[model samples]
Target: MAHDDSVLIESGLQVLKRYASRGETLSYDDLHRELGDPFKGADVAVQVGKLCDDITVQHSKATGLNLMISVLVRDSETGLPGEGFFQLAARLGRLPSTGDADAKRAFVLEQEHRVFMVFRPVKADTSGFAPNH
Candidate 1:
């Protein structure tokens, strides 16, 4: 049976959100595992690609922050095949000023695939959340 696009997208979002909330990055293998067995050989990668685009678009509409989720394919450091990892891009409220250098640095340092909501500009605020990227 063919899986509906909306269902697949929702499932993907839930998975992303779950990991994000925990301040963790999701690898392609991790995502596939969450998807369970393929139904009639459905392409999980294709579905995930679509889901990523949808999430980026949906989150971009929010105020204060322009959030984006990206799927990155990189060569494995172990010399294995290329692997994919998810990352979150966040741009705070407005353009950075001279005094905002520290904040921008902190933001970039904290910009991983983990949930953005839990992230704080100050390092002290991130004491509880350990990033797995």
Candidate 2:
């Protein structure tokens, strides 16, 4: 990314954590609103989506958990992640790129719920990194 990825990842993680605690989801607009300087563009949705992916990858790498935090960030209207999430997931072999809407929606919910379950209060790691149970 042209911007500071670490900063965006940090901010995006904070926001995703808050939403996960509430068992809720947020849109890219909601995420970008709290993130630091926005990327130079007419719309920052693409930027926020990339940040979400980065957060998921970084946190998973750090925690050794396969759950994705990006699932918590979605479109407010459709209540699902943007195409970028599915595209990345497909590239990662998490989902089929040609999956239908229902299948995609199901995948998103499954991941989102998994994210919430993992982030819930637990007696695991307290290293202030990834949440654990």
Candidate 3:
């Protein structure tokens, strides 16, 4: 039987949420491994984008916070393509968005095999969040 798109998306969400909760990065290889058959023959990027949208909506309704997921791909070795790194971020509803800055930082940290940091926004303070790495 063919798996439903919702099933695939839910599976992806579960993996993403787990990593997000731990402040860990998810690589393309990791996602492919965990997602298994559901991800087969699907446009992985589109699926991830959908997953991000779902996460944003669910997170917003549940916590009144904004959720962002970023994906980064780069060259692993001098002549080889690298895998993608996925990162998540949560921010207060009132703060001006820093856009992809935090995501980029998280990607860099993941590339270095360092700790992934989430810079959560604080009320009445906009000086910039701390680096968790």
Candidate 4:
């Protein structure tokens, strides 16, 4: 049987897909506006956080203007498709750990890719690194 989509999955992916299509980032408030009727309940913020947790979306810091959402593709070498929203951490130079269940999953996936790269042997070029004599 086909499983029902999680509430977060449906609404979150909808929001993300819209932004992804636009190819532009949006702040949280603007995102709420775009969401229209779906943005409701006291749990909205919590839901957004969850969305970030799931790696389906991301949230930014309170910029006094608008909280931005990250739709940037992670490193291509990582072999991950371009998706997932994550707020960037200023210090770490990457998305700050959400420290939630979702964050853990993202972390694990990242590490897994790292390990994969480490094990994969580099392809040799016919021309040596030093150059031909």
Best by TM-score: 2
Q: What is the lDDT, from 0 to 100, of the residue 61 in candidate 2?
A: 80
lDDT of 3 by residue, 1-133 (tens): 1233656656666676567546555555566567773444557644544444454445446555433432222232311112222322323232233446565555445433321233322236456887567
* Candidate 2 lDDT by residue in tens digits, 7-123: 667777888888888888877887888775576686677777888888887787888887778998879888889988898788777887875999998898889888889767665
Question: Candidate 2, 90: how far from true, in Å?
Answer: 1.1
The residue-level lDDT of candidate 4 at 45 comes to: 48
Q: The CA-based lDDT of model 3 is what?
A: 0.44
Worst 10 residues of 2 by lDDT: 1-10
Residue 23, candidate 3: Cα error in Å is 2.8
- Worst 10-residue lDDT window for candidate 3 reads 78-87
Best-first order by TM-score:
2, 1, 3, 4
Candidate 1's residue-wise lDDT over 1-133, tens digit each? 1234656656666676677655555555565567673332466555444456555445445333454433221122422111122222323233233344455444433444334554423345556878678
Question: How well does each candidate superpose onto the true structure, as a TM-score?
Answer: 0.45, 0.82, 0.41, 0.33
Those runs of model 4 whose alpha carbons end farther than 4 Å from true positions after fitting are 1-5, 37-44, 55-133
- Model 1 clash pairs are none
| Candidate 1: regions farther than 4 A off | 1-4, 37-47, 61-65, 70-114, 118-133
lDDT of 4 by residue, 1-133 (tens): 0113355445654565455545434444454455563547886644444444343322222222122233322323433322233333323345564646566446545543443343345667867577659
TM-score for predicted model 2 compared with the true structure? 0.82
Instruction: Please say which candidate is ahead in lDDT: 2 or 4.
Output: 2
Q: Rate the local accuracy (lDDT) of all candidates.
A: 0.45, 0.80, 0.44, 0.42
Q: Cα RMSD (Å) between model 3 and the true structure?
A: 11.1
Score residue 133 of candidate 3 by CA lDDT. 75
Arranged by lDDT with the best first, the candidates are 2, 1, 3, 4
